[model samples]
Target: MAHVATWKKDMVSEIVKDITENPVVAVVDLHGIPAPQIQSMRADLREHAILKMTKNNLMLLALDEAAKQRPGIDKLKGSVHGQCAIMATDMNPFKLCKKLEATMTPAAIKAGQLAPKDIMVPKGPTPFGPGPMIGELQKIGLQAAIEAGKIAIKKDTTLVKAGEPVPPGVAAMLPKLNILPIIVGMDLRTVFEDGTVYKKEVLAIPDDYYKTMFATAAHDARALAIDISWTTKETIVPLVTKAFREAMGLSISAAIPTKENIKILLAKADNQMLAVASKSGYKSDAIAARLSSAAAAAASVKPAAEPHKKEEKKVEVKEEEQVSEEDAAAGLSALFG
Candidate 1:
């Protein structure tokens, strides 16, 4: 008894240390999770973060120690028994949470398993054999019968309601049908990063939803950064290049916009169209015309193209030929040649 107590104490201490150091922990309720899927989840999570499957008591003890930094982490005190997995990560917590939710598969329903959400068995045709078992299925609101020595649901049926207990007869049949509606994983979780505490809701996002949200947020942030001149290399390249070319134009009376600057300016200008519209409200064509006129003027006033050395050589040869013909007529051909 003393040995067992000591072992438990040490185990609790280890779990506490993990949660403390990681700072981001996900409490997954494994009550309805199948053994095979649980193993798969463990392997998948290891690729991106750490998953610890331990007793709830141990996890509570760890949360108690780290409660000062994460005040609400102790909310996970309950729902950590039988089968539970703790996921920890330093990356974006929401992304990780969404990833876990995507792997849910149908499993045999078990007694005492809580439904994660509403379980809706769609109504459709059932194919059952005509037998005593057929009447049993019909009793439970299922259109089923014994046909061709096999039990077939004659039509679709709603076996159980969401948040309701699975009737004994239906529960037994669930294993054969392979349907586990409840997902057992972390419900309430938290993350502590850079001195900030993020709640489990932060990670409670769908993958596609979070992806779309982040993309829009990033685009908005970039646009604001450019407008405010707070842009970094990632955000400043286009804006600065445009400004640099504009400054160069002011230096040279040349009306021609350099080819290099054309792309740069166009990109910045195109991006800032909404801002321009908000300010001056001038149509795009008018702005483009003014820019084109300036560039063309610069090109026209620029120096003409100079003659190449080869062209000068050809001109000198022509002059010599004229002189040689005159010399030949005057009997000075030898001297000229």
Candidate 2:
């Protein structure tokens, strides 16, 4: 049987040791990243994680060996493809993914490289002066115009849609325009934590989005617990407070006076009585006195100083003016005759 190479054995042993030591084991794609950038990333990540680059077979073997001790460590084997590396960290998988995402730096797009997101040429004056560059820009579907003796993008134009391969023309023109549309960094593929493996999709959550979801979930959980009257340490205080409020409200409504609601109940009863009395024309002494004073003032204002005396005239009637009934009847008979 052929023996394993000494270096391979050493690397496999080292990988096993790392997987055993670190709580998190991740698979990362290091394709297209330059060696200098890789070294820089290694240094940057040295504080929180350790990066290991080895042959895929060696990595698989190491994982298989390590899996004996750590139950799910070998699950990272499925993600081991295409210029991959292993990262061992004490940090949890989610935090490690976030840290890696933060280390990304914008890089110029390469020919035939797919855009990670919409690539737009901004509307502004470029360093390029008026020349054939305008035709070149126009050739790549960018609106270019000559302004102030310099070349400028007429408007923001989408040169490449996300998931679409960048054309050679657009790729060549981007560098001249100083447009960096590609973000280059170590891409984490998968992570093994304890006995579980989490994929990139699972770990790639925006920090704010995750926090908002978690907060909303926690609030909903609390509300549901209170709604169902579930007893828990978290719900206890609010539950007790709510119960006390409801009980107090019931006591007030029933007029069962307690220390907390006695004053409120009395004030409520007093207000009701005052309302009833007001509607029934009942008035206090002060109000009655004010009304009496107003009436006296009105009477005094009406000519009390002059003393109004109505003038009288006698009407006279003569007794001779009265006609007898017999004379009236004789006059009526003479007229008829």
Candidate 3:
């Protein structure tokens, strides 16, 4: 057996222990990032994660060894290229991604560096007074002019386009214009959990995305369950309400009376009787008086609609049934909201 250095063994063990303990493990790219910034990021993430940096070979060895117990952690070794570090956290992968993204700060672009996006100089007053500075700005392709006794850009100028190398002259003037184009910090490459690897694009989601998705899913699920007449603790109330509505409609059609639907049924019958009497030209004084009264009442106000009524009554003479919206909402919120 080959003799391994004690420090190397300890480093690998430390990494292995972190992987096994924390549910989230990630490879973060550290290319072109300063040591001071790395220290600051480590401090910021101290509460939510553990970040470790060492030789890439040692990291690979640790991942390989840990995979013996973890099964698929070695897959992360593919992301080990470039200056990188291993991070372990108990936080979920999505949240960890956001946390890491939050650590990024705007950095000034350097000469010969590739521009990440279009750098625009807005048309506005500048700090420079009328002097040779105007000539310097014009040299950098900015439409500079003297306005209100101060240097002002004539129009918004594109200092650098995406993927284009920033010229030395343009780079020097960006700081004077207060435009920091490059985002500098620890960048996440891939995350590992439960034997799965999540890439940067997959983890980059809005903060409320999952919450919204879960809520929408819950709503669709409840709607589907109701459509299928499937009964569950969540769907029982709607199902019961539907059943009661159907039962009430059936009873009215068959002229069966119940306390809950009796008023609406009576009103409907009265309207029907009046309609028949008016069409038949009946010669009864009581009928005439009643029809006049109904007309006056109709002109003044309309009765409540049957479809919108939610007032609950006993399906059985002695048993009371009710659905608490607050309770249902609470339960659904606990489950999917």
Model 1 per-residue lDDT tens digits across residues 1-337: 4455777778766666666677566666566566776777778767676767666667777777667766766655654566666666765666665676666555666665554455544443334444576576667677665556677666556666667777677777665455566545434444555555566566575558868988999999888887787859777797887788667666333434566444433333332432343256444554445335434554476565466623211101111122222322332222122
Kindly list the per-residue Cα lDDT of model 2 for residues 217-333, writing each as its tens digit. Answer: 999999999988899999999999999999988897899978887656655554343334435665565434433543465456555444476632211222223334453344333
lDDT of 2 at 202: 92
Error of 3 at 254 (Å): 2.7
Q: Listing every candidate in turn, what is its Cα RMSD in Å to the true structure after a full C-alpha superposition?
A: 18.1, 21.1, 13.2
Question: What is the Å distance of residue 298 in model 2 from its true position?
Answer: 26
Off by over 4 Å in 3: 1-25, 46-71, 88-95, 193-196, 201-221, 258-260, 279-337
Candidate 3 Cα deviation (angstroms), residue 41: 2.1
- After aligning candidate 3 to the native by TM-score, how far in Å is the CA of 68 from where it should be? 6.2
lDDT value for candidate 3?
Answer: 0.84
**TM-score of every model versus the real structure:** 0.49, 0.65, 0.69
Give the range where candidate 2 is weakest over 10 consecutive residues by summed lDDT. 311-320
List clash counts for every candidate, in order.
27, 0, 0
Candidate 3 least-lDDT 10 residues = 313-322
Q: How well is each residue in 137-249 modelled by candidate 3, as lDDT tens digits? A: 99999999999999999998898889999999999999888888988888999999998999999999987889999999999999999999999999999999999989988
